[model samples]
Target: MGKNQSSKIFSPELSCTARIFTLTPHFTQADHAIAGLAINHPQLVATSSARELGRHSDVSEASVIRFVQKLEYESLKDFRDALKKELVNSQTAGNSSVSTQPNTPTEALAQVVALCSQALQMLTTAIDIEELGRAADALEKSTCIHFFAAGGSIRVAQHAAFKLLRLGYPAYAQSEPFSQIAQASIVQSGSVAFGISFTGSTKSVVDALAAAKENGAIVICLTNFAGTQVTELSDIRLITPAPGGILAANSAQTRVAQFAILDALLTLITPRCEYVEK
Candidate 1:
């Protein structure tokens, strides 16, 4: 066990897969194999004996025990118990339960599909129909729409903007903070400022939304967490189910949820919005 390793590495906010990825950089070369095995086959890690895991990962029995200890677990049994709990939590949290570890490509796809389905299922309830309707109403009346996002979320922002463009709305997506701030100054009462931040703490999106709000633009936000800076600025907030992450912003499942929200908006606005010159 590494003495320098902190128990704080395991945060409740992070999923089991997130914990493994975050700690992988700090692990020894042999521990890397254990990390992969644990992520793909958590049940095996929970049920297998130390000798069995060692044989499976091509490490010694002592190394297997050391790996568990390094994760701040007191004993192999404690680690196994924690793993069991995580597996159950994942299944309950709409993260899906696939008893068979994904060895084949098809099996791996089943897990992926299951998680995506879970995310979508969570969104059906997470979204407030009234809020969605208000957002659609705002978009229908807007002369223009501005999308604010940063990092990976920028792509999602761009996607939404392009969809609006085809629907005859003058829409633009800005990832660069300064450009967004500058652009926000030009937006007015008939404009829509749509912010995308899964974690809802993105300073770029928050700042843009704030600026647009001050300028009398209808502020809208798409986020996973509620009561965040971006959401606070929004007149219409679209919240989605959070797929836990250490990074916290955009997880794959959360992206699926966000996309579904955007798709729903497009559906609603299509009938309400009148075509304008694009």
Candidate 2:
């Protein structure tokens, strides 16, 4: 594999297993078998041979080979090499490091509060005023606004859309893939499209944003990472730090950060909008 491709496969933003799961709808039986192993026993997949993996996953050795190939690996050896590197990197970064679980509900609630506070603090430290201003400027100038998201992020998109609507902006948030793509395709110049994906890897949101950009709409992305495919298609980016761990992608911390960003952006745009006229 090329250096850049290998780097992406080992990126900390998304584990190899998470990447596979994200694209699981297109997977076959063999792909499912390998992906299952990657998710449940990543260390085993990194250390074991293709034959061993096939046996454990209840698939043929040939199927094992095909599975790696389907993930864009050049060969079984290449896949193992990347897996090993990712495992090492994750270990070094202490991705699995966390305090012991709370023994009681009260303790757990306290821990949750602590984590949320830290996440919001991090958000405040990382936010760039200039970028938020730029985003607000884009929104203020747009004739219409479309919010695109899927899965858990659709809630955030819908919330933002409602806030903008109440402020008299022409805004919409569509959860269905077909409706999102249709709206993106028809958005005219001076329109703004906001794509929300915590991992910034959701194909539907990425494609819809790309479609909007192609049709002359300004595209903005609210994602956890800047280098992801979804961000690549955006004209402006509002980024939040990823909450680390197995449930990182679904963390409430990230959701809180997204809401905070949305609130700030809306506050900035409210003064620019002629809400009284509407």
| C-alpha lDDT values of all predictions | 0.75, 0.75
lDDT of 2 by residue, 1-278 (tens): 25366544334444454445334435676676677567546678988898899899899998898777666676888788877776665444333344466788987776666656655755654555567789999998889999999988899999989888878888999989999999888988889999999777899998899899998999898887545688678888777655353346666776888899998988788543465323
Best by lDDT: 1
TM-scores for every predicted model: 0.63, 0.63
Error of 2 at 28 (Å): 36
lDDT of 1: 0.75
Model 2 residue runs over 4 Å out of place are 1-99, 271-278
Clash pairs (backbone) in predicted model 2? none
Clashes of each: 0, 0
Question: What lDDT does candidate 1 reach at residue 146?
Answer: 94
The TM-score that candidate 2 achieves is: 0.63
Per residue, candidate 1 scores C-alpha lDDT tens digits across 203-276 of 87888889899989999998765545886788887877653432325457878878899989988886424763
